[model samples]
Target chain A: MTKRKMFLRMITASLLRRRSRMLIALLSIAVGATILSGLVTIYIDVPRQMGAQFRSYGANMIILPGEEGSLTGAVLEEAMQVIPSENIVGATPYRYVRLDMPSRQQSFTTAGTDFDEVRKTSPYFSVEGEYPQNRREIMVGKEVAETIGVRLGSSIELSYKPLASFEGEASADWVPGAALLGSSEGFNEAVLNVSAVLDEEGKISEIEVDALSQTENIGSLVGTDKAFLDQFLGKSLPLTLGEDVDALSGATISSQAVVDALNSSRSRENARLSENKEHYTVAGILSTGGEEEAYIYMSLEDLTRLTQEEIMDVAELSVSASAEELEGYAANIQEEYPALTARLVKRLAKSEASVLSKLQALVFLVTAVVLALTLICVSTTMMAVVSERRREIGLRKALGASDGSIRHEFLGEGMFLGGLGGLLGGLLGFAFAQMVSVHVFGSSITFQPLLLPITIIVSMAISAVSCQLPIKKAVAIDPAIVLKGE
Target chain B: MALLELKNISKIYGDLKALDNVSIRVEKGEWVAIMGPSGSGKSTMMNIIGCMDKPTMGEVLLSGVDISKETARSLTDIRRDKIGLIFQQFHMVTYLTAVENVMVSQYYHSMPDEEEALEALGRVGLRDRARHLPSQLSGGEQQRVCVARALINHPELILADEPTGNLDETNENIVLGLFRQLHNEGTTLIVVTHDPEVAEAAQRTIVLEHGRVAREVINENFGK
Candidate 1:
């Protein structure tokens, strides 16, 4: 017989000679290995599943202005340093301006945004019509567009009320007679041509007003507007001058100036609107279903004019990598930059945290207990075997077998048993893991290719170590007395 | 030439002295028997001479090499190669068949061959029963297998302890005849026994009293 075959035959025969006792040991080993394989599989998959589950919440990380910070674009860029540029998927800045809508005959809030950044950062915004491209083109929310009867190519006036300047912290009830820079009537106004109308969840600049008088025809409204203009201008003048006399009453001029200033700003932005259609394109439109439909979608320049700020308010950042290396990317960003955090969410995050953590902990604890019990079971079995075979060991030694050879024989038996058990256990463990994964997390578990060799090696090592004392005792048996029965 | 020697050998087991200052010599091709009363140290001397045990004092020499200083490994080498052992109880591995039992000795040798084992069994006239296990064989047949095992390695010294002590007359005669055949083949043999009849069957007989050699006698018709 070949050497390996002979050795294997010897091991099999030896094991067979004591099959009843060894079966218990074998069973224990198998159980231990199964638990080990299953738990390890879950451990490696934890972070990936959790990250993805968290990502489904729509926003992974939000960029709020740092404490004691400005919403200016430059300040936003500085805050970007604290964030890992690689982990950010998108960044958008926002600025709001309060203005009057004559068509609505009421005050409304308005928001100016970089449409490209908004589209990249907000997955929730749903647009119904074509997105706005030119400065003259504005997409209004469904609610405001309907009230103004403004279709595509319709011109609308926008007025902005400047923030009241105060030297120190002021209570909400405190009111300045007139804004230090200018009264509302002295502020800027702009006119925008409607390009598209959005569905809902739109944004609008905030403005205060009495009402807009609707004229049946656009031609008749512009034609008879001189007497109306005289009255409008006459009422708007005294309100700014009389604001110091009474801050809360008869200040229609300051209020009307806010409306005019908003319109003027909108018209000026329209002049600068160049539909390059390349660097500047319609990213998306938000449909707030209110004045956002009357509000306009534009570039950073349009947003600055509407908000009366030098730069955009909100900033968005993002990074991309191969699907396989996404986890590494996340880890690298988190490790390299602790100030910023990246999160992957929704279903992946929720399952990973809520389901996987509990499951893994359970598996780990169970595996540890099973492994310890397996070691004890195998060790006891082997000790009994060594004692029973004391005479056999003596005989072999008397026959010129070295102590090393004797030890090798026993260790070989342990290794063989361990490997056989591990193979069987690994198969069972993989099935068990899959079942638990599907039942608990609603996903099929994949068998890892790496566990095969690792299981066998670990099982063999554990068995060998457990068998150490018994094998040594067997090797050191006194042959002379054993042979003579002394 | 002397193949075995003992000088002032003694063996003590706790409070009992199994052998005390015993000395004996056996020449090559000699068939010798050691006779003693119970506890007279004959068995103890046999154990020492066969290298199974060492004397508490004194030395055992095989072919003039002192064996008292030999390590356990070296002593085992002596048992496997230089000295062949046969027991009265047959001492055959019961799991193996007749031929396999004979081949057990060849395991100690570096080059164990099936052909050599078969030839040795054939010499002992047990080739036909080669496939029969020890349990299947009669007492005499099992002893013959043991003889074949001992001769297969062609050891320089053959130590048989009570080779026929547990056998009937027929089996005893069969085993004694085999020893004669081996002695004719130029192998030195030492047989330890308590019976005078068994001692008389050997060419020379040494008697032990207490732990020392008492007397030596020559048998005129050992083989006859």
Candidate 2:
């Protein structure tokens, strides 16, 4: 019986003497703590569960340009700032353009897109051959290719249709979208930085660097193209990259590499020269098996070069937002910029909103009721304990125990009961919460480790406060009368 | 200055006066016994001396400090550090073992030590029954446990109210023998009882009648 155990023994002895009372208090406390932990777990995790459920249903929100003009890449960039960056998991812009196939002498609808964004937005894209890399190249859909009687490496002339310039308010807010995506890398400085291209023999070779457009093929500029030059210029050509060359006619030709005469490799024509063209190649074809298969792909820079319109005429933007947040996200965007219209896909958005709101309200109500019951039960039980221990209290007080010491003893007993109850309740609550989640939400719940201390503190507080009147009455007992023999 | 003094002390309950102007002094290490018939205010005086009750008038001085005017907390400290009490009913906390009951006094004073509490119980011949709860002990054994609890704090003054009221002749002899040993070692003792044998063992005897001191006498059998 050290001093510490002396204090603890007094409390435990008293509690153990009245085991039934403390056990009742403990049970009530445990029940209260369990409900408190379970409801809080459910409350915090419901949104995530609902979000996952909604994602399984498909696209949540879409952003369309204002009627005054089509959406620019600048507006898209600003829109990105307003929306949460991580939440916008996928985004792709669409612009419908027209093309003229000279073989048929008729125009057809051509959709312009960023193929990378399209891949994330629609995962179903299945490729046959390759997608187009530049303005001069195009990936003809199976139906379109069959109609045009074209195969791989087939290039069709695209009709030039410039974006109609927006005036007043819409154009006033625009930033050049094409400039945002284009890099301003200096070719001369870049070439100087490349120390050497090593060969298998460990010898160093100096390599020439050429500035290539987004549409240009980097392979065409790498090695000597004398064979290509001869085939294109209709004569055996001499290489004149570093110095002037004399064509067979004895005329001195000042040299810069010149690429001449182009035709699609798969075209039926023997040789049809192009008036003006970009270095282009087919990268890969996307066959989504859906309507996205019909859309042709190209970068915004390629579109600007081909149409001579330095604008991003994005008709619509597909934004990725979670179902629970879609409505709020759209509202935030509409509030910030009144020009744009945000439409919910409505496939699962309505259901997600309704379920989340009701869930939070129900959790709040259940937690409140349980807390009230716990407080009442713990308080009543502690009061009874104090009442039954009046003689013991009076004896201790007579033995030189101060009023404060008496109060601490009883409060310690209450808190000990509370802590025991809380431990039991925390475990019970985690199990209950997990079970509820599995049964109702078909998901596992997360446990908040912080609840253990909180439950014990709360229980102790309630029990101490409840035991006050009884303890005070006990403290006021006259030791003289209690000890006086009858 | 006397180690314990009661000056013009009076206790009243509405119209009834339990004590009236009772004054007495006991020197350091003196053993005194208080004896009286029913309604003689013997118990009331003990209560006042132990700081368990405040007198209606006059004062109690211990070590030259008037304790009757002190606050409840100070009185509690006085009872804890300076005075120990033993009741006829034993008043051992029922749920605690005999050793734990002894430790309770030490706990209230400063610190409780198992060795000190066990030694105190051994002094009263209850060492073998140290782990027995009050309900499990005989009346004599219970009284011995109470004595051990009172002695555990090494109080300056010990007030025994009917100390052997419930004990057999053999247990009474054992208790008196322990008090004789304590008196030989110079511990102040106050025994309140109707038993003449208990009163005769003390150095002085004070007799009360109708809340007043009827007579007081020095005892010849204190050490004998």
Candidate 3:
């Protein structure tokens, strides 16, 4: 230990004696180590942090209900009892029903759910209007609102049609199981002319509805009182309701996908006719930039009342969890809810994995390049030291310093610088990672305990490797020539 | 038996025969001064004797060991245990203080001891300036520190080339007085210089001209 200490002292003295040059090399190593440690930390952590971010895209584990169109019993409650609430951000029940738009003579997708929990589950949805609180309103998504010729507070009619419409006399009304040779004649498109909007009072209001889509032909009808609004409050707004023929002028009325010139998928097959009709006003507009953008949402109570069945249309329940543990969570859910199948949102998980892998690769590449540059800088500086201390080395050699002793001094110096550089770099790298994470990802990361040892090892390895040629040069000095001042 | 011996040693630098057919021997505790002008192969012969360079053709024996065929590592051991060297330039690691510079030799020789280094500095009469860096010291003082460093290893052979060549009259007297004191204590020393006064202080003086020994004189009043 004394010998070691003496060697350390010698190296320390040597370093102090050559501060400027050694400082430059130390700074280079520190910079390199900082980049290495910081990027590695980010590479490992970015996936977890970004995965949490993508969780806002919604569920990683989606548990489908027993049957395709319905859940059995108070099955959602059973599912809740089975799943640990700590892991659950949202466990909402949903019901899907066909919405018949009499104004547009078509059916659309209307979803029924508790909107409050949905806010937590899919927080990335950018809502333009407020969410509905009661059974008397509907939340129309952006694509639906654009496809449908409706905006906030516009009255629409939806008819329930779970099955096919049969051949019958084409009347103003369409009902299921009737031989309705459905023709576009005697169809009385409901014309709601709002006299006044009653704010929680049995009053009158005037509402002028302008059909935004060319397929829609809305006419005005004078309406007043609570009964009028209530009767027209729970209807489904089909995606094709507001088609303004004047806007389309010489064009055909179709869906949002067909409203463009480049849409090749828009055909006559995408249309639907409803057997029964109910009315509701558009209460909200939601924009999510996802599949949820095309949905019409309502409360389950209103949907049940309209369908005249205790309708539990919850076909699936999506649970928010991390990607790594999601599969295990899914398996646990399956063991508990034997009738239900719990599976991961594989596409989302896969894409997130792909992104994380790419980022890790990029960090590795940058780290490698930085390390190479560090080796070159350190090696060059050490070589300069060798050149400067030629006389000193030669003197020591003549004074009976063995090759091992000379090597020991330089090796100690290299390791000391490496260790010091690593320590400084590790701390600075963590700080930099925090800054980047907070600035770019808008979130903070946790500290990794493993980074310390990793940086030290890498720094030491670099230093030792860089010292090889310089040490050889130092030990190879000829005392005779240098003592002669040659 | 001689403490140091060279049998027909020849040192060649490419085409220049720096030392040709030179053979010399010195008994234990002998104080010898090797006198030669520049390029007379004085430095070359010293280098071979000091184990800094191998003789191109000859046998060298130190303390009865034929080390002429020794490898560099073994030569290093011989140099550490039996030989010490000094130069006119006072080649100190300029950054280290006097004490640390002396300790450096001790460090390579064995374990470095701070007290021993201070004692060595005291021997050179630079005890008070032990903490001074080489640059802070006067030229003669730096040379004294180099002397301290060379003696710190306790070698049997101290080979000093131009020990007082760069010193002033008073500094040279002071340095030569230390050498005379060490020689009286029976330390073997080979002082290489062209100064007749420096050679006169030795028990024997060997003169070289053009790489061969020209003359050898025995000094009867070396101490007086």
Candidate 4:
């Protein structure tokens, strides 16, 4: 037989002769390997699992208007594109405005948002009824509903009156501007300078008019006509000559021309600030114990139609990722859309990171303790075996075996046991990790195939190191004394 | 030239001298016996001669090489190449069978040859018991296996220390007969023993007392 085959045979025989002692060493190694494999698996998978759990709390990121005064739909879309879609749970945009309820003599802060995205970003919002479904429907906060004495299914009228800021000023030169002139038959033909201003209550505070060019008869009544326009001041918008004020008695065409020109100029000043009055049903009552309870919420589509403007003040996002990853995404968003500022909600991000880090540290400590104990136990058992085989070692040395060969035999036995134990422990460790994951997190874990080989290599290294002291003892045997029955 | 020589060898431990100024020599193909009482340094002298140890002072020349000055590693190689040892306890590896026990020596010396190991065992009349463990064999059978193991490497010298001390009368005769056969084949033999019958079987006898050689005697009887 070959020397290698003979060496293998000798060690195998030696190990089998002392099976009971070797079993204890094998068990220790397997247990250590199991804990090492299981804890490493848990350590790698914790962040992803915990990140998903933290998402249920609320949005952890927000995008607000940057240098621009407000955000637009294009900016929101660009921010969403910068963040990976798979990591985004929700992205909701909001716009706020204040409108008056003349019947109650009070104005309420109104918020325009998407209800579909609100379900993901603001899951804590509890509505008494339901979100607004149409332009004629709106949701009122609990504080607003109680103060206004409105319940579900009740109707409330909201009005937006345009300010009477003038488009064309009446200068002393009395030069009429064509762009400010309206399409009335006599109005377009005449050259008239008109100017107006509104008070905080949207009432016409001041009025001025100059008839630059007109018929000789009407031009003669210009001084009298200026005094007639004063009666229209202190009146609300959409004023009519017949309803709001009396017409000039003898110059009816000039009186119609003056009134039409002033109204046309108001329309050109602020297109969105027209006389908007709409009745909407109270669809839902929000009862959040925060600032959200003092406002009215409605769909963005409906708000856009009412105000004739499409914009958002801020966007809230619920993204499932670690704090560092969230920071990277925020950086990307700011780089791509400089007009938007992205920020993380530090309270939620810090708490998630803190809990995840502590858990990983605990697992690492436990694994280290287990491996140390295994090393001590295996070393002790191997020392006992070496003690028992003192005579055999002496005999081998006497038969011309070198110290190097004796050491090789003992180390080979230990490594072989380690390799076998590690393979068994690797399979058992995966199952152990799965059990812990399912029981504690209420979820299953994925298998990591790379851990098996790594576990085996570590196990073999530990076993080889454990054999050092025992092999030293074995090589120190003196054949003359041991064989002499001493 | 002498096949083995130890000139004024002194082995000391602290203040005690185990072997003081011991000198001896054995020619080629000679069967010599060393006889001594307890504490006479018989085992110590055998250990030095077998290359398991080195002397503190003096030269031990085996085939013209001074082994006392050789390093431990060099001594191990020299022992593996030229010396074979037989112990009194028949220290067979308890787990290995008889044939495997013989092959152990062959493995360390060179590549183990099962056929050669079996032939060595057959010469010692253990061919039928080659597969039995040491515990399963009788005292005589185990001793014969040791003999086979010591001869597997075809060493130039055979050093046997009380080889027949643990055997019955019939087993002792069997082992002595094997030694006689090896001696007849021109192999050198050195037997350290307390038995007069074992000493009388050798060609010459050396007696030691108080770590010194007191006398040497040669046998005059013919081979018959």
Candidate 5:
């Protein structure tokens, strides 16, 4: 037999004598190796998937009115002129009102806009019933429909609270109470017809108002309310009706205040939407399974009106250029529009990559722990084998076996265990990763081919570490005492 | 010049003396028997002569080189290259076949020859049983295998510690006959035993009492 063959045979014979004990050690090493391989595979893939999921939600940028901080028509016109028209798909100005759904006691903030432009900008809205073709039809969010007991073809009674501010009496110093009806000025309310119910596609919702009322014709109604105040030029009076809470409540103005705050926020969001018409649109309503679904949608123009902010707040313009050109575009935009910030949000497959990285880290940690523990087991097993064969070792020493030969024998045994376990672990780890991915990520996972080499290398390292201690112990055995039992 | 020599050899275990100032010498081609009752330190003397153990205070000169000054490792080399050992129980590795047991001795030598192993086995009349494992061989056959193993390296010194002690009369006689044949071939031989019959088989006998050499005599008609 060749020297190597003889050495291997010695190891095999020794291991075979105690196969049962060694099998457990082998299994432990294999398990550790498998986990290492599988987890590493996942760590490399998560970011790309996550990034894709985020991209699916279209709002990569937001635009606001100019630094002048005014929503004047002239300002909007100037902003529009500055941005190229070909880049802007749709734009509409927005106005908002606070409405209280008395039946459900739910507050809905409404955004008034040109529905034609709004529909064109936001296409993800899944309308259960046909959308309104004219100004009278109003689309409602699905959560609002469920709460207010209103559906398509149903006319919902929405009371829009009129502003109770007394004009020309230091209007800037006026703080309106919660109840408009019981306040110094009487409450103003209006009603609208529900045209369609929209599913939760990509809707924006606030905490207080229901999402359905975002599209109510709040502008025309608020304008009319202001016209009514123009009629009664100067009046400060608190008007109380009969003992009917439904008709007029006192402290329910907080709900109206919530609706107002929601409306103002929605209008501002709309202005930003219009300002960045190229990058964003009214995707859909965010139902969130809560009472606060009251939100608004607008075309890019309407967002510009409501937000009353700078053009930089709204528009995200992308030039038809290569990756290298993106830096130049950003630089040019920065220099030309010094007030505006241009960021290159690369559509990186980061989400999937991050998921992969995390999975990789987890896999590495698990593998390390497994291999460490297995090394301990292997070390123990080797120690036992060495101790058990002290007499044999001494006899071999006496019979002229070199220290290298003895050490080689034990190393061969360790490597055999490691390699065997690694092979088994690699196969098992692949299956394990597949199972975890399918169960956790809810998708089928592709097996990475590289895990095989990684598993083998890791297993070998574990065996090498595990064998060192026992090999040292074996080397320390005194030949004379061991052989003659002196 | 003596092929093997011991001067003032003594071995002490705590306060008790296992061997006290035991001195002996054997020239080339001589068969010497060391006889003693149990605990007379005959086994200890054999161990020292076989290089299996070192004396506490003594000089073991093999071919005129004092081995007491050699390191334990170098002593092992000396044992492997110069002396061949046989045990009372025929300590052939049981797992190996008869020929393999003989070949095992050659492992210590730098150049092991298969033909030399076969010839050694043939000298001990164990050539026919060469393929049989130690357990499969008869008692006499096992002793012959052990003898073959000891002689395979053709060492200058052969130390047999009660080689036929565990054997029947016929096997003992066969083993003794093999030894006589090997001695005639000019190999120095030392046999440690308490059996008078075994001692009578040797050309000279050394008697020990109380860990000391009591007497040494050359038989006029040894094995006649």
Candidate 6:
């Protein structure tokens, strides 16, 4: 037989002779390896799973107007383009406006937002009925509906006077410039400089009008137009021609033409003021127990049409990413768009990070404790084996066995046990991790293929280190004394 | 030149002297016996001669190489090359079979040869029991296995310390007969024992008393 074969035979026989003791050591090593593999898997994957779980709570980030003091739909779209789409769960832009209720003599705050985006960003908000589907439909909060004395399907009339400079005073007239009028044949242009004077209570106290028509026959009636425009004095806006004002005498078509010009000028001015008066049906009641319960919500499309501007005050975003990654995205957005401020909701981000880190720390601590205990247990068992074999060691030494050879035998037994236990533990550990993940996190963990080799190497290292003290004790045996029956 | 020499060997254990001013010599192919009472330093002298230990002060020249000054590692090499030891307790590895036990010695000395190891066991009349563990063998059979293991490497000196002490009279005679056969084959033998019959089989006997060589006797009836 070869020396190597003989050596292996000797070590194997020795281990087999003390099967019970060696079995204990093997079990300890296996348990240690199991914990090592399982906990490491958890520590690496917890952040991703926890980040996803936390995203369900609400939006953890908000984008607001920067130094420009105003945000637009185009700017929000541009900012969203820079972020990866997969990371974004939802991003909803919000626009706020206040409209007066003429009959109630009160103003109600209103917010315009996309309902589809809100479902993702603010899943916690519950609507009593349903979100508005059209411009004529609106959703009011519980407090808004209570204050307005309106229910689902009830109509609300809201109005807002034109706040532009041309509304209350004769600052300018609708000239259309000479080129625009002259470009079209048979088109008569008129300049109507109309102004309303309001009292302290916002009631129209007086009205004035100056009309100049480019039509050839209408130029001579400047004195007569004073009487014609005087009929509108002391009247309130949203006035209708022929209903609120008397028609001029004799020249009926000419009078109708002047009235048409007046109505066209007012329509152009009202576009900037955004529909001075409108009626809407209350489609839903929002019952959120927060500030949102006191405001009226509508579609952004309708709000844009009314305000004649595509602008938003702020945008709320829900992203599926860790706090650090969100910070990186926020930094990138701010750098790219100086007029936009991206902020993370610190409470949610910090809580998610804190919980995940603590869980990882706990896993690490448990793994460390298990490994230490395994080392101690295996070391003690090996020491006992060495003690039991003192006479055998002495006999070998007397038979001209070197200290190095004696050490080799004991180390060989230990490493062999370690390798066997490591393989068993690798398979068991993955199952252990899978069970824990499914039970605790309600999700299945991804298997890491690299951990198998790592576990085997670590087990072998533990076994080799555990053998050092026992090997030392074995090598210190004195053949003369031990063999002499002393 | 003497094949083995110990000049003024002294072995001290703290305040007690196990061997003091002891000197002995044996020529090549000589069979000698050492007889002594307990605490007479017989085992201590044997230990030093077998390279298991070093004397406190002495020069042990085996084949003209002073081994007293050798390092522990060098002593192991010298022991494997030139000396073979048989213990009184028959200290065979309990797990290995008889043949494997013999092969262990050959393994440390050089490459193990199972055929050679089985032949060695055959010489000791243990060929039939070659596959039995030490626990399965009787006292005399276990002792024979030890003898086979010691003789497997063809060492220059065979050191047997009370080799038949644990055996019955019949088994003892069997072991003594094996020692005589080996001696006839020109192999050196050193027997440490308290039995007069065992001592009488040797060419000469050295008796120790209280750590010193008190006397030496020659066997009168030779070769006949």
My TM-score estimates for the predictions, one after another, are: 0.61, 0.62, 0.80, 0.75, 0.61, 0.76
Query: Which candidate achieves the best lDDT against the true structure?
Result: 4
Tens digits of per-residue lDDT, candidate 2, A380-452, equal 7767766676667878888988888888887788778777877788778888888988998798988777876
Give the alpha carbon lDDT tens digit for every residue of A312-340 in model 1. 43344432322234445445545554543
DockQ, cand. 2: 0.44
lDDT winner between candidates 4 and 6: 4
Runs off by more than 4 Å, candidate 2: A1-5, A16-18, A50-60, A63-324, A327-341, A345-362, B217-224
For residues B1-224, what per-residue lDDT tens digits would candidate 1 score against the true structure? 47888888888899888887888889989999999887778777877887778999998889988998788778888877887777776666555567765555565455556678888888888889898977789988888888898788889988888888879998898888888888888989999888788889899999998887898999998767
Highest TM-score: give the candidate number: 3
The chain B TM-scores of all candidates, as shown, are 0.96, 0.96, 0.96, 0.97, 0.95, 0.97
Worst 10 residues of 1 chain B by lDDT: B103-112
Q: Which one is best on DockQ?
A: 6
Tell me the whole-model lDDT of each prediction, alpha carbons only. Answer: 0.62, 0.67, 0.72, 0.81, 0.59, 0.79
TM-score (0 to 1) for chain A, all models?
0.49, 0.48, 0.70, 0.69, 0.51, 0.69
Model 5 CAPRI quality: incorrect
Q: What is the TM-score of chain B in candidate 5?
A: 0.95
lDDT of 5 by residue, B106-136 (tens): 7546544557777888888777777786679
- lDDT tens digits, residues B126-157, model 3? 99999998989998999889888888877898
Per-residue C-alpha lDDT of model 6 across residues A68-102, encoded as one tens digit per residue: 75788788888987778988889988887765566
Docking class of 3: medium
Q: Give Cα distance to truth, residue A42, candidate 6, Å.
A: 0.8
> lDDT (0-100) at residue B105 of candidate 6?
96
Query: Where in model 5 is the C-alpha error above 4 Å?
Result: A1-5, A16-28, A35-140, A147-149, A152-287, A290-292, A295-368, A402-404, A435-439, A442-454, A476-486, B88-108, B111-148, B165-178, B194-196, B217-224
